[model samples]
Target: MASPAIHIPHGPARSAHLLQRTTAEWRERGEDLLLFAYGSLIWRPEFEYAEALPARVLGYHRALRMRSSVNRGSTHQPGLVLALLPGGSCRGLVYRVPRAIGEEALPQLWAREMPNGVYDPRWLHCDTPSGRLRALAFTLSRRSPNWTGPLHEPELLHIFRHAEGRYGTTLDYLLRTVQGLREHGIRDMELERQAHLAARHGLCAPP
Candidate 1:
C-alpha cells in the first residue's frame, strides 16, 4: 500500500504570514529551505544539510518500522529504518539548506536515510523560535504493509541490533536520539525509559 499524501489544512490567519515570511527569507537568500528530521539525520549531519536548528512540529508521529521491502544493507547487515505511525507525536530538529543546494542534497539524504521506498516526503508545518513555518518531512509510504502501527522499544532494538551501515550501527541512531532528547529538554517518560532499557541491554550505550 502506498502511503497516501496528507494535506494539512492551512493553519490560522497567522499561519499564512508565517509561511510567507519563511518562504520569502529562503527566496531572498536563495536557500533551499528547512526540513524536519526526526531520525538518523538528527545524528548524522553528513547525510543532509550542514546547518540544523532545534525545532518541533505539531500533529505528527515518528516510529521505527520499514515502509518498503527495499532493504538498505546486506542481508547480514541491515540498516536503521523509520516508519510513520498513527496516533502519536514526534519531536526533532529542522535543517536548513540553500534552495539550489537542496536539489542535490535531498536525493543523497533520501538514499542514506530512506534506502527503500518505505518512506515518502511531504510538506509539514513546523514550530520554530521565530514562529510556525513550513518544512519538508518524510513519512511512511502508503503502499507499505507496515504502515500505521505501534512501534515499541523492543521492536526498535531488534532492528537496531543487527543494523550496520557506512555511518554507524542502529545503536548510534538510538544514542543520538537520547542525546537530542536531553539537549531539547523534552520530557517524554516513555522515550526516556526506552533509551535507558536499550542502554542497559547493550543494544545501545549511553553517551
Candidate 2:
C-alpha cells in the first residue's frame, strides 16, 4: 500500500507576521518568552528551556480537536491532536527559555507550531505554583477549516484505530499525552476518557 501523504494546509504560517511582531514587542520590553506546551510538547519538547513547571491558563481548554496530517496522523485518515480552544481552563506545563536565547527561540517555535497556520498564537496569563506568567498559547478557532467539531466516541475510536502519520499512530499520541498529564498531576478528563475508549476497544493497550 502506498503511504498516506502528509497534509499541509495552504497559506502556511499565516501567523508569521503576528509572531514576529509579538517577538519584537517582547524584545523591546526585555521580557523573556514563555512557551506553553499542552500536547506533543508535553512529551517531546525538542527545545532547550531554563525551567519548566505546571501551569494553568484561563478561558481555554485542551481538546484532541485539531486534525493532524503530519505529526500525529496522515491526511488519508486524519488523526486528532490537542488544540487550545475557547472556554474553561487548561492545566499544562510552561517553559521559560534561557534568557540568552529567549528571543531567538520564537522563530523556531513559530516554524514548528505555525506551519499550517491553524493556531492563533497568543500570550495569555498562566497561573503556576511559582507565580503567574504570561505564556504563549497555540489556540485554534472553531471557524478554522481544520477544526473537527465535537466528534462522538465511536468516531474517535475509528480514528484511533486507523490513523497514522509521518510521526506515528494516533493511539501513541493520545497515550503519550495522557501519560504526560498523569506524570505532571494534571487531569484532563476528556483525554483520559479517550484513552480509556482506545484501550477498551483494543485500539491501544490500557494504561
Candidate 3:
C-alpha cells in the first residue's frame, strides 16, 4: 500500500536548538564521534573527517521516503529524498570526526542536515570491517509530516524529472548518490532500479 501525501512544515529554529543541546552534551564528554552516511552525506559530507570506512547496519534500510523542499525541490513540486526507514538493512560508510574539531564541526553538520528537523537524529550500531561501532545517523519517522510514504516508480520518475532545488536538480542528486555508492562497491538495488527508470525516460546523467 502506498503511503499518503504529507505536508511538511518549516522549523529550522526549533531543530537547531535541539541539535545545539545534543551536540553540546557530546562535546562535554569528549567522546569520539562517528557519523553514518547513507544518502547525500556519502557524496556531500561537507565536513572534515579523520577517516571513513564501509559499514552495514541491521534492521533498517534506506528508502525514498522524505520530501525535499529546499535541497532538491520546492513546496509546490516536492521531490523525494532517501531516509532510513524501518526493516531490512543498509550498507554505507562510517565517518570519524576528530574530537579536537568535534565542537566546531557538529554545529555546521546540524545546520546542513537539520534544516527543518524532518529527521530524527539517532545513534545506531553498525558493523564495520574493523569491528562493531556506534555512529550517529539521521533516521526518518513515519509519523513525521515530512514522510512521503510509499511511492510508485512513475511517481518517482515524475518527481526526479522536474524537481529542482537550491542544491541542484533531483535527477542529479539521484545520479550522484548512485555513483557514490558504486565508488565504494555498495549497490542499493532500489536506487539503481530508479536510476534505470530515469534513464529510460531520456534523462541525461550529470557529467
Clashes by residue pair, model 3: none
Ranking by TM-score: 3, 2, 1
TM-score result, candidate 1: 0.67
Off by over 4 Å in 2: 1-10, 13-15
Which window of ten consecutive residues has the lowest lDDT sum in model 2?
1-10
List, residue by residue over 49-151, the lDDT tens digit for candidate 1: 6566667766667654552223433446554456444445677778887677776675566555444334445567777776776777766544455463556
- How good is model 3 by TM-score? 0.90
Clashing pairs in 2: none
Least lDDT summed over 10 consecutive residues: which range in candidate 3? 1-10
lDDT of each: 0.58, 0.80, 0.82
TM-scores of the candidates in the order shown = 0.67, 0.89, 0.90
List per-candidate RMSD values in Å.
Answer: 8.5, 6.7, 4.8
Please give the lDDT score at residue 115 for candidate 1. Answer: 44
TM-score winner: 3
Residue 136's C-alpha lDDT in candidate 2? 76
